[model samples]
Target: MYEAVFHVRGEGPYERATAESTTRIDLWCNDHCDLLSIVGDGEELVLDRIREAVGVSQRLGDGDDRLIVTSACLKQHAEGYVEQYLAAHDCLTLPPLRYENGAKVVRVLALDAANLTAFYRDVASDYAVTVESKRELPTPSVDAPLLSPDALLPALSPRQREVYRTAHEQGYFELPRETTTAEIAATVGIERRTAEHHLRRAEKKLADALVDAL
Candidate 1:
């Protein structure tokens, strides 16, 4: 099996808004409507925009972070939606679909590289798409349990974990990285040198732990 991570832009309203703001949105979709959890500033404005765009059936949580249920199916509303295309090409989208900085960061799984490539090409025909990472995964046995971060990673210092995770989630480790160390530092409110130091230490610790286990 193959796993491909794509950074897609110019596809949906959430993507467009997120690109222009610091807000982050994680979405779960169905044929009916989308369930979205939003984090960061401008929650009220974002919510209002969403309500105007598609209507909101319910809202939960408080402050700038909330969980919302949309009245309309976002996939059906967005012209560039490619779920059907993904299904047609035998690609499965792994959720929750992440929207930030005006793009959608999604992971897709396919039986083979050819199907992954075809799916990418088809999606790229309409939207600006960038392949962040792609790799082959060993086929799992029927009895194997799903993998979790706690099972793979050793304990890390809070600061170290924060710095490393910020870098990773923002695509610092991607083939063509989407973010810079300076940007990461700014996001995490640390100096660039300090963030780099923490990240390097975290990486070394993780690598040592993984290698030793192997």
Candidate 2:
């Protein structure tokens, strides 16, 4: 999946209040979207809700102020929504924003570009009010193999390899344990459910491999 991040900066009456308020607005939008009956698909609805929640009414005065908005989404329609959001709000500046953290970053998997684009569009349309500047980001892939040190290494898929590596590196097998399932999920950029699935599959494979070895 392709990912994009947009950054917006503006000056207006609510510039100072927008940062923290925008976050709350996004959450509120997500909650409202969750309650919509017509919103089909959980992921789409969540994205729409976040946009709608943040698109509340804000009265700006004649006084000059500046505000900035940053958005990140998968590469399909996210940019469109961001553009729409800026248009709807009459935001002053619109530009591309990049997220750089040297090496480690989050990655999203999509079946194809179409699916990724669709996800981005949904997010952009919902939060049209406060977004000033936005940009699209490339999704990163994790190349590490997901396998245990045991013979089962050959059977594990790429995802499984990541799960196993994360567990091992984080010392999941240690007496006290240094990380939890949730932590592993965060590290691997997968949901807790996905993380759990990989871990379980890896463990079962390792167990069977150990028995065979015996």
Candidate 3:
């Protein structure tokens, strides 16, 4: 498997605002639409201008100083175009476009070298693309692990896996902790208490699997 990253500061009002403003914006796309998360140095904050700037069509709050925004690119911009291009090439975008000063750094996972090469070639026509990094990842699908993930399939329930993946990917386990259980709850579209309960259950199941392997 190959993981590739690119940094872009293309033309868009929102992209300009993000580059110029103190706030940081990160976005994730679902092939057809997008999910946005924005943060700023705490002060008198306003999102209405951001909404206009980014062309955000819908929003839901995750509380804890976060907003989950949904948009289908009300304006022709880099993000929407990138998502479409990746989807066309059958590539999976690593979630959450990282932003600083209005330019975004996004990661993409390609199943093969052929597709990865195609993606790079196609995107260059539109953006001032630069390969920030590339790495060959060991994978069970392409390569093989001594212990297959299939061995632990029964270790956790579907609900357990769902919550655990969300928690892990959302940086719940990061040092200087970036998110709370309640915030994760909102991100997974579940209740806070339910998220906490499942996270514990998932952890225990994973622990048990590890112990069994040992």
Predicted model with the maximum TM-score: 1
Using TM-score as the measure, what is the rank order of every candidate, best first?
1, 3, 2
lDDT of 1 at 210: 86
Model 3 clashing-pair count: 2
Against the hidden reference, what TM-scores do the models get?
0.67, 0.30, 0.50
Query: Order the candidates by lDDT, highest first — what do you get?
Result: 1, 3, 2
As for TM-score, the candidate ahead, 2 or 3, is 3
Q: What is the Cα-based lDDT of residue 194 in candidate 1?
A: 80
Q: Give the whole-model CA lDDT for all candidates, comma-separated.
A: 0.78, 0.40, 0.64
> Candidate 1 vs candidate 3: which has greater TM-score?
1
Model 3 reaches what TM-score against the true structure? 0.50
Among these predicted structures, which one has the highest lDDT?
1
> What local lDDT score does residue 49 receive in model 1, on the 0 to 100 scale?
65
TM-score of 2: 0.30
**Residue 112 in candidate 3, Cα distance off native in Å:** 1.7
